[model samples]
Target chain A: MLNVEKIRADFDVLNPESPAKAPVYLDSACMSLKPRQVVEAMNDYYANYPACAGRSSHKLGDKVTKKVKKARELVTEFINAKSDDEIIFTRNTTEGINLLANSLGLQKGDIVLISDKEHNSNLVPWLRLRDKIGIVVRICPTNEDGTFNLDNFSQLVSGAKLVSVVHTSNLDGVTNPAKEIIKIAHQAGALVALDAAQSIPHKKVDVRDLDVDFLAFSGHKMLGPTGTGVFYGKLELLEKLSPFLVGGDTVESTSYDSYKMLPAPEKFEAGLQDYAGIIGLGEAVKYLSQFDFKYIAEHEFKLNAYITNELQKIPKIKIIGPEDPKLRSGIVNFYIDGTDMHKFAVMLDEMAGIEIRSGRHCVHSWFENKKIYNSARVSLYLYNMMEDAETFITNLKKILEIL
Target chain B: MPCIVALIVFGIMGIFSASHRALAEEAFGCVFKRITFRPCNTGFAEKIKGKILSKLLVRSAFLAKMVNRHYEILSWIFFILMVGSTIWVGRGVYNFYVYGSCNGLNESGFCAFDPSGENNKVTSVGDDSSCGITQQSEQNVTLENINLSGFPAINTGSKDTVVFVGCYACDYSRRAYPDIKKLVENKKSNYIFAHYPAKGDTMFLGEAGYCVQKEYPEKFWEFNDYLFTADKDYVLNKSNLDEILSKFGFDVKKISDCANSAETKTAVQDQTTELKKTNLYGTPTIFINGKAFVGPKPYRVYRSAINKFIFF
Candidate 1:
C-alpha cells in the first residue's frame, strides 16, 4: 500500500499546510507535478558541473559525461532494455515518434498500422509519411467503449510493414494488449513501435518481455523535467534504422566530403543535449523504481474508482471509456452534453484550486469522429488521496449545480 | 454584450496591471469581432462569466445558478448601465470644464472630480451659523426685477453689463473681486458693484462705499478694490476706514458725515432691499448679461457668460 500523505510531502506544490494555497492536481496525464527530488537533481547539475557531455576532456566534462551515461543506463534498466546503447534521449514523445517517422525507411505503398484513436504525436507523423512517401496508413477500429479490439487489429496487420500504435490511450486510458499485438505483428513480418507516453508511468513496460522493436515515452508526464524523453530499440534494429537528425556530436570523424557517424544512440542524438533534464529524468526513474508498480497501479485504481463511481451518479455525464474503472486506470474522462469543457476546467481551477485537463486531450481525430467537441479529464497519480478526490467531487457538484 | 463592458472596465484596469492588459487585449479582439457582425468566438465572455460564477458558487449555489441562468440578460443590463454611466461621466466632465462645477454652475453635490464640491461653495446670505438664521435653499436664487441703477457703476456706456453683488468682509467675495475687476477693465463692459453685507460687522463698509462713490466717483473703484484686498482685521477698524478715505483724496470728515447721515443710512437700507429682490442666496453673486452666477466662479466661467466676448 502507498502512503500518499508521505508521498505528497516530496512535492512542494502539494503541501497543504503551507501558507500558499495548494492545488488539488488531477491532470497527471497531461503533465505530472515534479517532486522536489527531481527538481533538486536538475538544480544540482546546473549548479555544479554545468558542462557539455561526450565532447570535452576536462574534469567538468567527464563528470557530465558520466552522469549522462548513468542516466542512459537507468532508463535502460527501467524499461528492461538489453543495452544502454539502445536508449536515445530526445525532447519528448512527439520528437521520439518524429525521429522514427523520418528514419524508419518505409517506402511507397508500405503500410503503417495505427489505432483509430491515437494521439497526434503518433497519428500525424504517420499521416505526414503517407503524404510524403506514399505509405499506406490504416486505422484499426476500437470497440464501442474505446477498448482495443484484438481481432480487428489482426485483420489489419497483414501486408503491413510496421504496426505503430498507442500502448495506452491518453484520451481513454485503456492499456492495449501490447504483448499480444507484438506477437501477432511479428508473425506477419511487421515491426512494432509502441507509443508508451501514457503507459510507463502507471504500470511496468518491459521491452524484452513484449519484444517491441521500438518504444517512446516522455519524462514530463512521469514526474521528470520537461523536454526529456526516451526512445528505446533493439541493437540490431536501431543499427538498421537510418539517422533522422545528424550533426556535430553524432559523428566520430569528419572530412570535407565525408564523415563517419557514431553508432545507434549517438548517431540519433544530434547536437548538444538537455543534460540537466536527462539527469533529472534519471532521478525520476530512480525515485519511481523504489515503489512497486503494483502499488502504484492499485493507488491509481482506487482513486479512479472513487471518481468514476461518483461521476456515474451525476445526471448528464458521459464517461468516454469503458464502464469499469480498472480498465481506464487512473483516468476518468467525461463531459456533459452542453457544457463547455474549457470553462468547466477553468471553473474547477477557480472554485477549489483543482486542476484538470480539458479540451480534446490532443486526440482531435477521436473527438471529431464521434462529433463530441471536448471532455474534462481527471487523471490520478500515486500522490493523490481520497480527500483530494472528495474535494474534486464536491467542487464538481457545486459547479454542475451552478453551471 | 459582456465583452463591451469588459473592454471598458479592463481597459482602464489594464493601465496598471499586465495580466489585465492581456484580458483587455482579448476583450478588444472580442469587441472588434462583435462590431463587425461576427460572433465573439474567443470565449473571453464565457471565461469571465465562469470566474464570476465560481466565486458565487462558494457562497450560494442557488444564487450562482440563478445568475448563470440569467447571465446573458444580466450582461445586457450591465452593458446598458455601463454605457449610460459613461455618457453621464462624460457630460459631468464637460460641465466641470464650462461651469466650474461638475453638476452645473452653483449646484453643490458630490462630484468625484471635486469630491468636496469646493467649486460651488459660497458665504451664505442670511445663514451664518452664528447669526441664528435658517439657511435658505440655493435653488431660490434668481435675478428677477432687480434695479441695478442704484449700485456703484463703472463703464456704464458699454452694452455687456456685469453686476457683482458682494461684501468687503466676506472671503469668497474678496477672492472673486480681482478677477471681475480685470475682466471688466479688459472686456470694457459696464460693471456694477453692489454691496450686500453677507456677514456681520460689514454694514459700515456698505455705508462708506455709498458715500465714497457719491463724493469721490473717480477713486471709488480703486478705493473699493483696496477695501476688498486689505486685511480683514485692519479693514474692520473704523479708524482704518477714515485713513483709507483720506488716502483716496476724499475729505475724511466730509465722507464720515455723509456715511453717517440719516439719508445715506436710508439709501443703504433701500439698496439692501433692492439686493434682496434679486433673490441672491450667497455672497459674490455675479450677473453677466443678466445670467446669474452665484459663487466665486473661475475666470473662464465669468468670461464664458459674456455674450459679446469670445470665449476660450
Candidate 2:
C-alpha cells in the first residue's frame, strides 16, 4: 500500500500544518503538482550545467547530453518501449498528436477512426488531417454509460488506416480497453495510437504489453515540468515515419538545396529542446517507479468511491459516467440540473480551497453531442486523503443548501 | 453592464498597472461586443462575478448566494452609481475651476480636490464691525447698481471693470492683493480699489488710503501697492504710514491732516456703506467683469474670468 502521508510530505503545496490552509487539490488529472525532487532536478540542470545537448563537445555540453540521454532512457523504460530511439520528446500531448497526424503518411480517402469522447488534443489533429488531405474521419461512439463500446469500435475499424483514441476519457475517467482495442485494430490491418495523457499517471501503461503502435502522454500530467511530453512508437514504425517538424539538430548535413536527416527521435525533435523539463520528467518517472500502480489505483478508488457516494446523496446531482466508482477510476464528474458548474467549482475553491476542474475538460465535442453545457470534475491522486474528500463534500453540501 | 463600469475604472487604473491594463483591454472588448447588441458571452462579467463571489463566499455563503442570484441587478446598480458619481465629479471639477470652490461661488462645502477648502477661505468681517452686513447670501451678492464714484480708482476709461474691496491689514487680502494687482495691470481694465476694514484696527488705514488718493491722486496706486506689500507692523504704525506717504512724494502734514479729519472718517464710513450694498461678506472680495469673486483668487482665476481662456 502507498504511504500517502509520506507521499504528501514530498509536495510543498500539501503542507497542512502551514499558517494558510493547503489547497485540497482534486484537479490532478488536469496537471499534477510537482514534487521537490522533480523541481530540484530541473534546478540542477539550469544551475549547474546549462548547455545545449548533442551539439557541443565541451564539458557542460557532455554533461547535458548524458543527462538528456538518461531522461530518454527513463522514458523508454517508463513506457516499456523496445528502444530509446522510439521515444520523441514533445511540448505536450497536443504536439505529439499533431506530429503523428502530419507524419503518418495517410493519403486521400484513408480513414482515421476516433472515439466520441476524445480530448481536443486527440481529436483536432486528425480532423485537420482529414480536412487538409481529403481523408475520411470516423467516430466510434461510446456506450450509453460513457464507456468504450468495443463491439462498435471493432465494426468501425474494418477499413480504417489508423485508429487513434483517448485511452482514458478525461471527461469522466472511463478508461478504454486499449489492449483489446489494439488487438482488434491490428487484425483489421489498422495502426493503433493511444492518447495516454490521463491513464499514464495513475496506472502502469506498458506499451510492449498492450502492443499499442503509438502512445503519447504529457509530463506535467505525471508530476513533471510543463511543456514536456513523450511519444513512443514501435522502433520500425517510428523510423519509417517522416519528420513533421524539421530544423537544426534534426539534420545530419545541410546544403543550400538539400539536407540529410538524422534518425527517428532526432529527426522529429526540432530546434532547442526543453532540456530542464526533460530532466525533470526523468526525475518524475523515477519517483513514480517507487510506487506500485495497484496501490495508487486503490488509494484513488477509495477516495473516488467516497466522493461519488456523497455526491449521489445531493439532490439534482447527476454523475456523468457509469454509476460504478470502480469504472470511473479517479475522476468523479457530476453536474447539477440547472446550476452553473463553473460557478460551483469556483465556490469549492473559495469555500475550502478545494481546487477542481470545471467546464468541458477539453472534451467539447462530447458535451455538444450530449447537449450538456459543462460539469465539475473531482480527480483524485495517491496523495489525496479521505479528509480532502470529506472537506469537498462538506463544502459542496453547504453551497447547495445556501443556494 | 458591469463591463461599462469596468471599462471606465480599469481604463483609468490601467495607466499605473499592467495587470489592470490587461483587464481594461478585456473590458474594452466586452463593452464593444455589448454595444453592438450581441450577447456579451466574453466571460468578463462571469470572471468578475467569480472573483467577487469567491471573496464573499468565504465570508458568508448566504450573502454570496444572494449576490449570485441578483448579480445582473447588482451590476446595473453599480453601473448607475459609477456613472452618477463620474458626472458628479466632472461637475465638481468644472465648478472648482470656475468658482474656486467645488460647491460653486463662496459656498464652503467639502471638495475632494481642495479638501481643506483653502481656495474659498477669506478673512471674515467681524460681528462687531459697523460694515452693516448681517446675512451671507452668495447668490444674492452682486455688483449691480453699487456706486463706485468716490473710491480710489484707476483705468477708469476701460470697459472691463475690476472692483476690489479689501482691507490693508487682512492676511488673505494681503496674499490676494499682489496677484490681483498683476492681473489688473496686465488686463489694463477699469480697476477700482475700495478699502473696507474687514479685520484688525485697520479703519485708520482706510482713512489714510482715502486721504492719500485725495491729496496725491497720481501716486495713489503706488501708495496702495506699498501698503499691501509692506509689513503689517510698519503699515499699522502711524508714523511709518506718514513716512511711506512721504516717499511717494506726498506731503506728510497734508496727508495726516486729511486723515485725521472727521470728514475723511465719514467718507471712509460712506465708502463702507456703499461697499456693503454689494452684500460684502468678507475681505478680499473681488469683482471681475460683474462676476463677484468672494475670496482671494489665483491669478489665472481672475485672468480667466476676463479672457475665459487663460492658459497661464
Candidate 3:
C-alpha cells in the first residue's frame, strides 16, 4: 500500500492548517493542489530558462525547447499514446474540445453524438457548432442514476460522424466504458473524442488500449499548473485536421498572400505556449507516476465508499449518480430531500469549513433533462484519507441535525 | 398558472377600484370581488405555500401543520404590506417630482444618502470576501540597482530591461513567477534576477544556487530550478540542503563552507541592503528600464509602462 500519510505530507498546502487550521478541501475535482515538486519545477523554468521555446536559437531557447519536448514525451508516456507527435498543448479541456469542434471540419449535415452527462466543455462546442453551421447534435440518454446506457449510445452513434463523450462525469465520476464506446463508435463509422478531464488524473488511461481517436484533459486537474492541458489525437487524424488558431510558430514558410503551415502539433499550437505550465505538467505526470494507479484507484475507491456508506444512512440525502460507490470512483454527488442544495453547501462550508461544490456542475442540459436543479458534490483524490471523509460525514450529520 | 393570472387581474382591479371607489360598475365590483374572492378561493399564493410547506411534513409534523395554516395568511400580509409600501413609494415619487425630494423630506441628500439597493445586493461590500482582491503592499519610492548572480538576464544590451528582485521560497514570489516569466517571454527587455532573502530558508536557497553557480556554470540554472520550481516550500537546514546540492554533483563540503563563509553571508546582507535601498515592500519589485514599475500587475501593465519608457 502507498503510505497515504506520507503522500499527504508531500502537499504542504493540504496541511490541516498552517498557522491555526483550515478547511478540509474536498474540491480537487475543480482543480488539484500541487505538490512541492510540481511548483518547484515551474519555478525552475522561470528562474533558469525564462526564455521562449522554439522561436530562438539561443542557449535559453534551446533549454526551453528541450524542456517542452521532454514534457511532450512525458505526457505521451503518461497516456501511453502511440506517438509524442500526437500530443498538442492546450489551455484546458475546454480549449482542447474547442480545438476539435472548430478543426474537425464537420459540415452542416453531419451528426455529433455525446452523452447527456457530459460537462459543459464537451457539450457546448457541439451545441455551438449545431447553431453556427446547422450540424445535428444528439445526446445519448443515460440510465436513471446517470450511468451511460450502451444501448442508447449504440442507437445514437449510428448517424453521428463523430461521437464526443466524457470519459468520466465531473458531476458524479461515473466512468463511461470508453473502450466499448470507442469500438461501437468505430463500427458505426464515427470518430471518438473522449473528454478525459475527470478520468486522466485519478486513474490509468492507456489511450492506445482504448483506441480513442482523440482525448482531452486539463493539466491543472492532474496536480499541474493551471492554463496547461493536453489534446491527444491520432497522428494521421491530426495531420489531416485543419488548424484552429493561426500565426506565430505555426508556419514553416510564408508568401505575401499564402503561408505553408507547420505539421501536426506545432500548427495547432499557434502562438507562444505555456512553456512553464507544460514543463510543470511533465513534473506533475512524474509526481503522479510515482504511485501505482491501482493504489490510486484503490485509495480513491475506499475513501468514496466510506463517504457513500455514511451518506446512505442519511435517508433524506439522495445520491445523484450510481448507487454503488465503486461506480462513482472518487466523486459522490447528492442533493438533500427538500432543502436548497446551494444553502446546504453554504451552511456546510460556513459552519464546519467543509469545502464541497454545489451547482448543476456546468451540465445544465443533463440537469434540465433529469429535472434536477442542483446538487452538492464531494470529490476525493489520492491525497484524501479516511479521516477527511469521516470529518465530512460528521460535520454533515451536525448540519442535518441543525436543519 | 391561471390562478396567478387571475390574482394579478384582481389585484389590478382592486387597486383601480380602491383609487376610484366612486365607480359603480367595474371599479366597485373589482374591490369587493377581489378581497372577497381571494380569501375564499385561497389563490395561487396559498397554492404555492401549500406546495412549499408540504416539504416540511417529513422533518417536523407540528412545524409543517403550523406553516400550512399560517402560510396563506402570511402571504396575504406580505401582499398588503407590499401594496402599502408601493402607495407610499408612489406618493413619495409624486412629492419628489413636484418638489424634487423624496419621502416628504425637502433636503437634496435625503434620498441620495438613503442607502443604495446595491448595498443590500447579496454580493454587496460584505460579500466581497468570496472573490476579494488580496490587499496589495505597494511603494512609490525610486529603487536602486539590485545585484543578482544566479542566472544571467536575456538582454543586458540597453538599460531597457526588467530586474525582478525576489526570493524563491516565498508564497507571494511564487505568484509573481508566472507573470514575470510571461513578461520575459513577451518583451525584448533584459530580465535580471536579484536575490532578496526574506526568510532563513530563502537564504539557504540563495546560497545553494550561488555555490552551485560558482562551481559549475552550466548546472547553476538546474540548481536554481531545484530551489524554486521543485516545491511549494523547501526546508533547508543542513542535511536536506546538502542532500539537494550534492544531488547536483556539487561538493557538499565546499557549498556548506561557502554558505557559512563571510562572503556568502555578507552577500545576503548586501542584497538586503540593496532591497532596502529600493524601498521594496514586496517580492518582485520590477524595474522596466531604470523606472521601478510599481504594483504586481499583469503583463499589459508592464507593456504600457515599458513602451512609455522606450518610446519617450
Q: In candidate 3, list every pair of residues with a backbone clash.
A: A36-B231, A36-B232, A39-B229, A40-B229, A40-B230, A40-B231, A41-B229, A41-B230, A43-B229, A44-B229
What CAPRI class is candidate 3?
Answer: incorrect
* Per-residue lDDT value at A211 in model 1: 98
Per-residue lDDT of B68-136 in model 1, one digit per residue for the tens? 999999999998999999999998987776677778777777668777655565677775512212224
Predicted complex 2: DockQ? 0.38
Q: What's the TM-score, to 2 decimals, of chain B in model 3?
A: 0.49
User: Which candidate leads the pack in lDDT?
Assistant: 1
How do the candidates rank by TM-score, highest first? 2, 1, 3
Q: After superposition, how far is residue A273 of candidate 3 from its true place, in Å?
A: 0.7
Residue A350 displacement (Å), model 3: 1.7
Off by over 4 Å in 1: A18-22, A102-113, A124-140, A150-164, A180-192, A233-264, A267-271, A342-351, A398-403, B2-51, B127-163, B178-193, B201-222, B246-274, B288-290, B297-312
What is model 1's native contact fraction?
0.72
What are the runs in model 3 whose C-alpha is more than 4 Å off? A16-18, B1-312
**Root-mean-square deviation of candidate 2:** 2.9
Per-model DockQ against the true two-chain complex: 0.54, 0.38, 0.01
Q: Report the alpha-carbon TM-score of model 2 versus the true structure.
A: 0.93
Cα lDDT for residue B300, candidate 1: 76
* CA lDDT of every candidate: 0.89, 0.87, 0.74
lDDT of 3 at B155: 60
Each candidate's number of clashing pairs is: 0, 0, 10
State the lDDT of candidate 3 residue by residue for A289-372, as single tens digits. Answer: 988988888988999998998899888899988889999879999986544566556555655567888778888887787777
Model 1: pairs clashing at backbone N, Cα or C within 3 Å: none
